[model samples]
Target: MENTVLIKNATVLPFTRQANGSLNLEPQIADVLIEGDRIAQVAPAIESAPPSASVIDAANHLLIPGFVNAHAHSMEILEKGNHEASPLELWMLYTYPPLQSQHLDARLCYLRTLIGAMEMVKYGGTTIQDDLLELPYVTPEIFDAVAQAYVDVGMRVSLSLHTINQPLHHTVPYLSDFLPADVKQDLEAAQGLSDDAWVDLFRQVYQKWQGYRGLVTTVLAPSASQRVTPDLMHRIATLSEEYDVPIHTHLLETKTQAITGPELYGESVVAYAKRHGILTHRTAIAHGVWLSTQDIELIAEAGATVIHNVVSNHRLCSGIAPIRELMDAGVNIALGSDGMSSNDSFNLFDVIKAAGLVHSAMDTSYDRYPKAADILKWATYGGARSALLHNEIGAIAPGMKADLVLYDLNTLSFTPRYQLPIHLVYAENGSSIRKVFINGQLVVDQGRVLTVNEADIVAELQDRLPEYAVHRKQILQQAERIRPAVEKMLSTAVSQSLSIHRFSRPLHYVS
Candidate 1:
């Protein structure tokens, strides 16, 4: 007999929008049947359940498909609140250097990944696309540690070994000058090391972890167009094709890349990717904030997905992505919280609210932004599509993976609620997530994580915080000391730079 579970008497939010330009929010008390790891049935009020079935009463709760975080850096959770006042460029100097240098060890890396996954799961995110960029120091043990954490917590993960081949001399502004001339030359010569290293590393990781009980999978992550060469991009694309895995990358994230791509590569960054045949259905690009109209068109035509980290982009002042334009151009747009260090939170509801508000403010039209249902789709189906898991995950339909979140409507924020979807998007937060189920397993029940002891995890992090802080302070001091030189270098190199720019395009009111 198959293991069976039933969730009964819940308000089912199927994330399916109706043709009437309104959410399909009709309240129906239903029973969801889960057989093993998949949703077996969704019916309106089943009278009786099998004797072997475990029944969960989801009274006064909204049952929805679990959220999909399409792009993130889970390893940076420890660096949160370090660079709040810093802009993108300065933040990179002060904040990222510490992560790249001191905190790149195996223990801390796994701990951070665990904590990040904990935070995400607590907030109802079932699938996470983690762009693991600290690959230079990663090991199989570290990857296994992180993967085990995800499995223990009952969350799905698409893990990637992020690789960047650009020389430190070309990438870091002031740090290059600080190095001895000979050392700088040697570092420049090591530009291609990241590609070869990551190819081998990920090949090993994928072979070990790709189908590990269907809980973990691996992807090839070339950091970005500017950070990778054409040859490396082609190799990544080919490897993704060969293994039938997904490819994740950053694209047109900053104005600097958009403006400098023509000078460096004789074409726009999107054009460069296209020339190398890197854009495809299995590709998911994070933060297309500076992508032009033509770039958006090309990406849509290529059937690629873009993840919009609205809060993170706003916090870093990285400029707003043309989400309306991208959606209008038929680009699949998903929601991501980015790294906790940049966004300062791992809550997808916060991102959903921020996405709706930001786009509305930009377009000066209420209808131009995503509606409550649209945001729901972005967080669920759109996210699954971004990670190339649409067929297996995202929806709460029969045959889909049993990844579901139950949000309580009894909270103060959701009082007097007439609309379930709107309240979920605008009012809900981590505290409202009462239960979380991943792949037919109850990982979090009654607002507590069932896999690991929360107190012990917190205690461990508290014990390690001071050591991380010391290293963080040292790196920040170094960045501050070299700030003037970096600014000078940036000023001399880039003629036109915008600190905070906004772009707007008319969205066809989709109902």
Candidate 2:
């Protein structure tokens, strides 16, 4: 960040909201001047540069604000592609046991997060909201290891502690009824961390690594509504108000979640969060896949942001989120790469395409579909808002932090290009990202990370993966033992009446 850098003659996509509330994806050719960690100016001609300024001749390049990934799970990078096409309930059972088993070493946790951050930076992602969980319980030392990984890899992160206090049998609707006594006993014994213990852990993390190297931040993440008690939610809300940090939560990722409210608490899950005083402008709700019209209105009124994880929703058989309705209701929409365990990739480029194309299938009206510009907006500035960095990182104007990316317009995806936004959303996969600058420091040049040793990191994982797989044998077996009962629990819950239909196919029509 010490040296000034000048990007010459790059075609830039300036994000602007239209008077009609639509996205304007207009491009302009300009030279960008970077002075230290912030943009100095952007114009047709930026004349004055110091002698040592780095010059990038971008004659035909697409310069965009580095992607702000609104949602992610860095801890799950090691567990990608582990679960095959399972719903949220079953997927949880499949993924969480190893963490509970205490077989995952702290070094493995660091490697997991480092590799994920590498992928994100390589794919032009500059910031992420990582809702990480340390199985069995969360500790400051273990959480700080993941934070150090992000710091070393040069990615801005909102490191959320995604811990659950409620027992397994109590997390879902009548899950205890299907499991045997031995399994029930196991669930009770493996309650992970207590509510108070988690609170102390959050305080420890907040004190130790909230703003390390100006890249890492913290968020209060109570795993989900059914998984965390109301009193704990209030505590988190109080902390949020005191610290003024972003609040992250998951709501209605599946049809079962959409019905959990009335069946358990006689309200919508969204209503339950609202009543607990958890909904606020600082709050970002992930996976609004099953939100009703009223729920959308409530979110709008609360000034909350709905994070759309399109890839995970589709991969897990979670139904499509109503982006059209949410946008129409004036709720700021953002995109996320949920977790490598579900998404299997940290590439926000693919997420953009999924966001662009998925909503069109639900509505026949062409105008109701998400525009390419709209999707790009979500990936950049909308995500900035989600991470509570909207004032700093998402835009490329003068005085903003110099987080930007240079994409090769010469690639086949952009070669013989039509509209830039359309091609970017429909075809690009981040392979053409030539350079990435975070805080005006060039961390990625020519498709490789410079901040960390990429080759050694990859080789280490390759060598250790087999040993890790052998170690995971027991945990996978335990997940298999509970899988059938959870499947039964899902079947039973699907029959409970709900006023909304989020799934593409109905299980059993009440009508």
- Candidate 1 accuracy as lDDT: 0.77
Q: TM-score each candidate.
A: 0.90, 0.96
| Predicted candidate 2, C-alpha RMSD | 2.3
Per-model clash counts, in order, read: 1, 0
Per-residue alpha-carbon lDDT of candidate 2 for residues 1-511, written as tens digits (9 for 90 to 100): 3769999999987564568755557889999999988899999887898878989999899998989889888767888877687677778766677236563677777888889999999999999899987677666667878899988987888899886777777767767888888888877777567778887888888888887777888999988777788998899889899989888999988888876777789888889998887889999999998899989999999999999999999888888898999988989989999998899999999899999988888867997788888898899878888888888888778888889999999999898978999988998999889999998889899998999998898888888888778767777788887877777888888887777777787654221
Which residues of candidate 2, in runs, are more than 4 Å off? 16-24, 507-511
Scanning candidate 1 in windows of ten residues, the lowest lDDT window is 502-511
Clashes of 2: 0
In model 1, what lDDT does residue 269 have? 85
